[model samples]
Target: MDMRNEATHIARQDGARAASAQQGSAEFLTFRLGAEEYGIDILRVQEIRSYEEPTRIANAPSFIKGVVNLRGVIVPVVDLRVKLGCEKVEYNGFTVVIVLNVRGRVVGAVVDSVSDVLELSGEHIKPAPEMNTSVDTSFITGIGSVGERMLILMDIEALMSSADMGLMDSAQVLQ
Candidate 1:
């Protein structure tokens, strides 16, 4: 190859390497629920708003906190702590609602507090272990470790799309 063509080819190769490095890592929005830490894909998050008392729906499940009006959009909110069977559910000043867009549907998840965005490389994430048969680990995608902190990476879309949530039926999700 000519000298000029060789230099251009080398630069393109470097650019490709940089892009691949970025693609190898994923960003997660970490949050607290009781004493445990959990994370969801940052791309799925729409916004984070302070905890607000939503208008309760009659006869709805306890975990379904209620619905909130977000700029005229009615968004159903779910308490992650309650759904995950946390020992204690408390709403304090630090509590916040994480708005998410799952499969074109808008939903809100209530968490203890909003932590920082964590960038975890593929190597840092480990597969979740198999526990008791009664426990459902389908929603748990993996466990990420960064220094002393460990984050339970959740497949929020799968959890929200489940039959129990009643937000959207599985058939509808497929469509």
Candidate 2:
């Protein structure tokens, strides 16, 4: 089957499995950017907070909005929409910061807004499409079907390790 067809079929099967396994499944924290919804494993989420103005870093990429003081540790914040190359939009009442701990690093992801936490099964995850957007698909764990909405499951470790993100090089952060 073609990629699209395969993806569709997988989505359908995943939906069916999810419907039956809804009673007992792993939880994911869902969030949005523009119209697209995304999710991360709840195990990685440390906290969720209102959008805070971060200290800008020199020579950092556009998506890297520098670090924010979370308690005492400075954590870098990444704008999900910009990182995904989504169209820029004005930040209004919906902006939020999803603090995540991935591979021993605590980073905050700036998303449009958080939706809700969902329980999903492994069978309900579809592999990401290959040769799609410029954003590395390897960072995608799978595609989750939550009711009528589709949530992109992110691989937090892979995303944190990605060279382009510049997170792996972070040594001494502001205290």
Candidate 3:
């Protein structure tokens, strides 16, 4: 029957599409900072949890929002909005902590809210724009776009492990 033949053709087409998507695209977990959106590699994400007040540590950095005990493991929470220099930072019902594993250390990143996971092909991503010497843009891998939405693709591992971040002493300075 012609109808049966058409259904088989449709199934083949769908299978091909799924195969190409798997080979050519990477998945990013999207989240909000202030007004802008950001994307991080989904592999780095451990879990998303409701925001909670963390124990304040003495003499820690301003952006470091203290630490929270996650199943007996203390995770240092960082307000990404503050670290990224957002104009305003507010915590409400929608706020969440994105627990991430960075260089074998588990840390929590506070964000406004999570959007969804996106599979973006290479063509959908653009290289990060160049900035002046004073600004630090090294952790920005690229910019990703889907329809009208634009996402700042971040290399979270690099940002969290860098010496300046002070979250983890990953790169040792031979001084």
Local distance difference test, each candidate: 0.85, 0.79, 0.83
Error of 3 at 118 (Å): 0.3
- Writing each residue's lDDT as its tens digit, candidate 2 over 1-175 gives 5565556546655644664565456789999888899888899999999997899999999999999999999999999889888899778778999998877789998999999999887666665655544334656656888578888887666676577887875452221
lDDT of 1 by residue, 89-113 (tens): 6788999999999989999999999
Best model number under lDDT: 1
Model 3 over residues 93-112: C-alpha lDDT tens digits? 99999999987789999999
- Comparison by lDDT, 2 against 3, better one: 3
Q: Evaluated with TM-score, which candidate comes out highest? A: 1
How big is the positional error of residue 57 in model 3, measured in Å on the Cα after superposition?
0.5
In model 2, the clashing pairs are none
TM-score for predicted model 2 compared with the true structure: 0.78
Name the runs in model 3 displaced over 4 angstroms.
Answer: 1-23, 171-175
Q: Can you rank all candidates by lDDT, best first? A: 1, 3, 2
Cα TM-score per model: 0.85, 0.78, 0.83
Best of the two (2, 3) by TM-score: 3
Instruction: List clashing residue pairs in candidate 3.
Output: none
Candidate 2 segments exceeding 4 Å error: 1-24, 132-135, 170-175
